[model samples]
Target: MLQRGVRAMRVLRASSVGLTRPAASRSLAPNAARFSSSRSRFPAPLVASPLLQRAGLFAAAAASTSAACAFCSSSNVAMSPVAEAAVAEKAAGQQPTVVLYQYEPCPYCCKVKAVLDYLNIPYEVVEVNPLTKKETQAFTSYRKVPVCRIDDEVVVDSSAIISRLRELVVAPTTASNEDEAALAEEEQWRQWVDQKLIILTPPNIYRSVPEALQAFDYCLTEGKFTPMERRLSKYAGAVVMYLIAKRSKKKYGIEDERQSLYSALDSWVAAVGDDRAFLGGAEPNMADLSVFGVLRAMHGLDTYEDMMRETAIEPWFSRMTAKVGSSSRTASN
Candidate 1:
């Protein structure tokens, strides 16, 4: 029973928040171009951000909208046939409704949401502060936020969610050869962001015993620390994590790892290039979304602001913020 409980605790810790950072902010330049170039020809549909998708907010909203429409009579029909069909496509599970669970100010959560918005996938957002909500207690079992529910399926982690989304959405193949190559490159970058870039978090954020203890205290006082533990126990656990990061740093050298992380970010931005607006060529693709999730951490932390500003990823950050800011305004209305 003790062992089982321990495993459950680990899972809970993993699911309560997103795994990426604010430093690697996503770009919407490509998406902006796509919309602008096609505005006269083909207007784009509303895109959902990762937070909305993971929290099941979009699905919930769609369900509400459909319910509202059910009250209309045939003689009072309002929606055009095409509009109705599009609604049905979303309602019938033709497109996945992503429900994201997250807390405000979490850089990782922001990163994931940026991707969702870039892709224009319809999603819902559920705001959850693990410290304050009992419902968030359920997350203690899984351990991460940016958890996604597609249809009835539950995906607990960001990388897993990305992989699943790629499988569901078919990439456009009719674009120019250059665009096709860009799409493939973007996909590869997405995988690296999830698998390789994510590993840098422990070293960067939890590098010392005091830092880990402070984090644990914050989590506890903030109400996120679990198991209803005494102060000492929580502090002890924080120390353990601190020790692990410290040891890892000693072996890997924190500065070297930081440099490598920056290099990866540089490579990712260079791949997008100035000519294109987005990583997925003209449309925001999985690559943009994936990278955006990690970059969020950098943006959230004041300490890294200068480093982020100095990098090639800065303009891309502006583009993504603009896109999300606009979407947020629309959603509020």
Candidate 2:
């Protein structure tokens, strides 16, 4: 079991270089809600299988490694929610103990952090050990990282967490058609962030051995592995991710990862347009934040630098960084 686990981690950790199957292309729904309730749950949880199962393990490790490799430093951002979420728990004389179980550099994990930071919700971070996953063992079935434990209830999936937190902090309001239309747009772009933009990251990051090693180095620096584990994972994970990246391009029909990324950014910029400061006009909406969060996760890598150089996303990104303020992390382990 131990040997199998180690082998799986080596093979799977590099899968984080954005190896998840691409979301099928779909047109926007006219009546898309402010946030879709259809959560991004992994197909199966870890404990359900006798074996540490390839698919679930791939998701867990991929999420962990992808998150840890990119934008490890941007965790601390200034809080800038125009309509601040109330500290409701404080009114009851008890604050919610929010603990984020994550893989430091994963874009999904980064998405969650972006929301938390934007809302100025202070929370603790628990870096899940990618191999043993003992940090999340209590969940039994749901073993993926970026799991959020708010007070007693546990929330898995990045979108679900973001939606739940918004619900808890900001009261729902009746909307005008204009408001609804705005929300529909936000929802569409948010979905695109998960399905389209994120799929391009791994292949681009692990385009070659050197790039793969650089990614693993970031992972090693940010993850909670021991000395021996670090040495093994860094070398083995990089090589595996490099191989996986090649297969990912073929599987996704991405002829060129960087070009695809640039095209995606261009599409986003076009949507924002010359008239509006953001997709939401004067303010950054959920969609804007979601896109920013995913892109921010790729920070510090060559892919990130290249994207910034090659795309028109920098201005909007700069605005987001200013609006999304400082780190809301109250603690970590």
Candidate 3:
């Protein structure tokens, strides 16, 4: 059984007091942006900083606007769709509703979020309670996230969800042997990334005790946390995740975790090859999205810098960032 403390820590934003609107419907709230932007600079935990002192006051004011927050929805009121009523809608005329069940700090969730935006598919965010999983229990018997329900068709796992999104949104390019082979090859790499590559992130991000603290700091600050919760969540959560990262490192067969991370970056860059701009040639495919999404979790950490400075992955990572960042369009509420 998963430990209660671990689950509690994962619930960085899981609360009953305030509502959180899905990101697909609106731009990030200002304080929310600051929290996210801090990813680029692993600053001190908000608890230690002056910001935490008044964050509760700010949040109290924000609660009025965020009554329709990401985790919970307002009664009868819905998160407005991203595109026009016609554009984001499917052919059936009845507009499709996509609800994504996720945890705020999870990498797989980050991947699904990227692809949903990249494909311009609007989705409502349901922040699952890591401890109780109250939000996802009705739909899934097991406790896992990045579970996407597209209208009535529900999909689990990040890669599967991405594949489903592509099928629904991306136009079929061709029906040829070459196309078949290309897609097969992409699928192989995508699967490999899920099984082998992504496991590197946990260990690397939480490489050291201090590094682990910084990561939880980012996670806690990015979400809403009371001052008391911030301090307790930081130290206690950091120690737990740091130990967990070590176990993950061993499970992934990473003899030296940092070296394995560097190797993953180098291998991916090599796979993309010098002949093309991306793995999908001019544009990124599911393979590209999968890698980028998993890697997104490492942003702002010291590990991210080592991967960038030491490997050739940064150029491609930046390109993917630039392309994917613009894809998140806010719906008019």
Candidate 4:
């Protein structure tokens, strides 16, 4: 079990560096809510068949050799059947759980969930109103939301969670012969969303009544600040965010960034288009999942609703939701 887990991890790492399957052509749903209710109550039991064991061993050996060759390092592959069993055990008999340490109104957390829904991955959500929950404080010392636990693995940040999910859940479709050539292209787009689109966005856009109330509630629970102090802190955070967005816009040229973002969105929409109903050719694929994750944030804000509605993006969003179905939709507070 340990050897197999290590092998899986190695394969995942390689894929992260552009080593695995080709870019698949498919469209996926737009939210994790699609899968939230369908996950098995327990982790699927590991098959103990001898044939499976042999296959696992072969896979581990091949992955280790590939890693060694790629990095020109001596093969130092290690396996731990015990550790693998532990992880499997941890997931066993539990609800299909996905515990998220997230504050209310966090766009990033919402983005992560959107991908999960699109992939129809079931998860248990734990809302961490940081100001009030001591457990939340303990879970993430840094007080970041969207910190997710899949069984024994603690996934910090949206990208990491997305990557982890892709590994554990098998996609419904396969990549075509031209997938390799497209992997880099898709990766480049994903990086742009993370570094430029998300990092450069203003936060005030999400300061709805629910979000403000949640912040106030959190402050009251933490008891570290008075109501006024909490308000001031949130306001200050917004100011800082605005300044950061302003600087980014100025440096990158707001028009240029906007154009780039729009172009990316347009390209993504076209890629999925009306033809097959998903970004990947027939079924949802990694590209569709990743794109949906980021786009969810872009579309969620009320400020962007009109912009989205006025553009080609709206239809694309509609098509994605239709394919994934309404079960994935979350109640907006």
Candidate 5:
């Protein structure tokens, strides 16, 4: 009975904040020209400095007249049939609704936010309580969050939500051989982020008792925990998570979790190469956004600061931060 209780505690700690940092303006160097990939249907943003580039991309995206703040519905651009239908519906006054069910700390939820911000999609956020999880009770099929409702259709899982959102905005188009290869590469790395990178997060976040406590403290500060729950989670939760993180290291055969994270990021940098400002050449693709979102969850923690200091990922990360900075379209409930 004791063993079962301990296991449940570990699981609960594994599942579960927000850190508010003031935004800043930033710049980026030039990148390679656009490739002819067909997988992801992202807007073709301008390739230039931060302000000028984003300005150009926003121009391309065109401002929407709809009350919904439809950022991507440009009349000049040819969208996929599905996207066109959504636009047409919006025109008919049936504005599309997007709602995200998530908790702030989850990397998976962050991934969805990154995609939405980059795509300039307006969405509402419903922050689910980590303890009761009563908010997500309606989603009995799959309770774990990052569940999203696009209009009337509910999509579960981060990757699936991203894919569905892509279908709603951009239409498929032909790409050159080189572009196809690049898109394929983007898809490959996006999968890597989920498979290889995400698993390393908890181990580093809870590598030691202090780190674990720090993580919980940040969570409690940003979360909606009651006073009693806060005390229990801040103290007891930290110790449990610390032990679970150690066991996680053994399970994954990771001798040094930080080193593994650094090496993995190094591999990503190499794949990105120095010529391109992003994996998607001039603009960020799905893979770039995925990595940024996952890593962003570690903000305000030691592991994140160490990563910025120790790795070459900072430049690219900074550029992405500038590009995908907070979206005005987002509202939190």
Candidate 6:
């Protein structure tokens, strides 16, 4: 069934790229909300899944990952037996139980979510606080958002998660899987998402004081914090991001920051070219999801709107949004 676009966006499983978040070590004030400083961000708190974890005040269904792919990092972590089993099951035509550990408004998490939802893969969510990831410490040493425990196996990094997931269900079992060149090409684009595209977001979204506050205001509500902490995290957080965004603009060599962002979008659509519905052809590939996921984090802001209006990304974006969203809604029904 075909469907029109609904609302949603993605990034960060907290990329080194997005606004610098508050220190996870900051202590809460005395006499806070019903939430003790030592309390856990439990899911019973009414989230999308039994496994969903959120840090701080409210438990959210969304999760985040670093904007960079797993390949971009050097992680010595071993694959979990549970993840291995899940992959085996998926390859064998069985559904694997996926537990996604994440926080909302994270682009990388959104990327994984989009892929999972687009593939119609069934999974549960665990929302861990971005500041303090108390919910899933037992599962991972890295302790980041968008950490997915596929059965017993734990996968970190959006690119790794997507690549690993494709190993089971996405890539064809036939000769097509043997195309190393095609796989390499796909990987190149995924890298572009992390190194190039995600870098544009921080400067664009937190470009001004007003924009910074607006972004944080929404985050504070979704964030885990006492009333006092909420105020601190809101105002102070906005100011910090506003400053950091400027530095980021300079680091990425974005002279007219907004234009740099717009140009990147244009380049992305051009890479997709005219014949394909997505970079992956008929459906979203890892590249498509990464691009969409990162941008999703800035959905309600000027950056998202300007990019949508100023670039050729809309048709493809709409196609992906409608297709994935329709499938998800249908599955829910």
Instruction: Specify the highest-TM-score model's number.
Output: 2
Q: Which ten residues in a row have the lowest lDDT in candidate 5?
A: 66-75
* Clashing residue pairs, backbone N/CA/C < 3 A, model 5: 17-105, 36-175, 36-179
lDDT winner between 5 and 6, please give it. 5
Model 5: residues with Cα > 4 Å off, grouped in runs: 1-95, 139-141, 223-225, 229-240
Off by over 4 Å in 3: 1-95, 132-141, 152-155, 223-236, 327-333
RMSD of candidate 3 to the true fold? Answer: 13.5
TM-score of each: 0.55, 0.74, 0.66, 0.56, 0.71, 0.68
lDDT of each: 0.45, 0.63, 0.55, 0.43, 0.61, 0.55
lDDT of 2 by residue, 1-333 (tens): 234334555665546534210112221121122222222222122233333343344334443322223211111112223112333443332335678888665777888887777666668888776545667777744545567786665666565566556644433367778878877887788768766887687788889998888877754665566777666656755765566567557867999888999999999999999999889777677788778888887788899899999999999999889877667786667
lDDT of 6 by residue, 1-333 (tens): 001000011112222233332111111121111110110111111122223342321112112222221101212233444545455556654455667766555667777777666666666665554434556667554534566666556666555576555645534433354345555666788768777887777788788988877776654565444666556545644554465566557756788878888888888889889998877666665667768777876778877888888878889888878755532211110
Q: Which stretches of candidate 1 lie over 4 Å from their true place?
A: 1-98, 103-108, 119-143, 163-179, 208-241, 250-255, 326-333
Tens digits of per-residue lDDT, candidate 1, 1-333, equal 223224434543665522211122223233432421110111111121222232221122112111101100001112223333444444332556567665433445555566556545566666543323333346333333545565655554444454444434333336777766765676577556644565555455455655444444434343333445325434544443444445445644556655766777788788888888777554556566556655665443432564476567778866766654433211210
User: Backbone collision count in every prediction?
Assistant: 51, 12, 5, 20, 3, 32
Candidate 1 yields a Cα-based lDDT of 0.45
Report the error of model 2 at residue 293, Å. 0.9
> Which tens-of-lDDT digit does each residue in 138-209 have in candidate 4?
543323345667766555545455544544443334445576445555555555555555543443242344
Ranking by TM-score: 2, 5, 6, 3, 4, 1
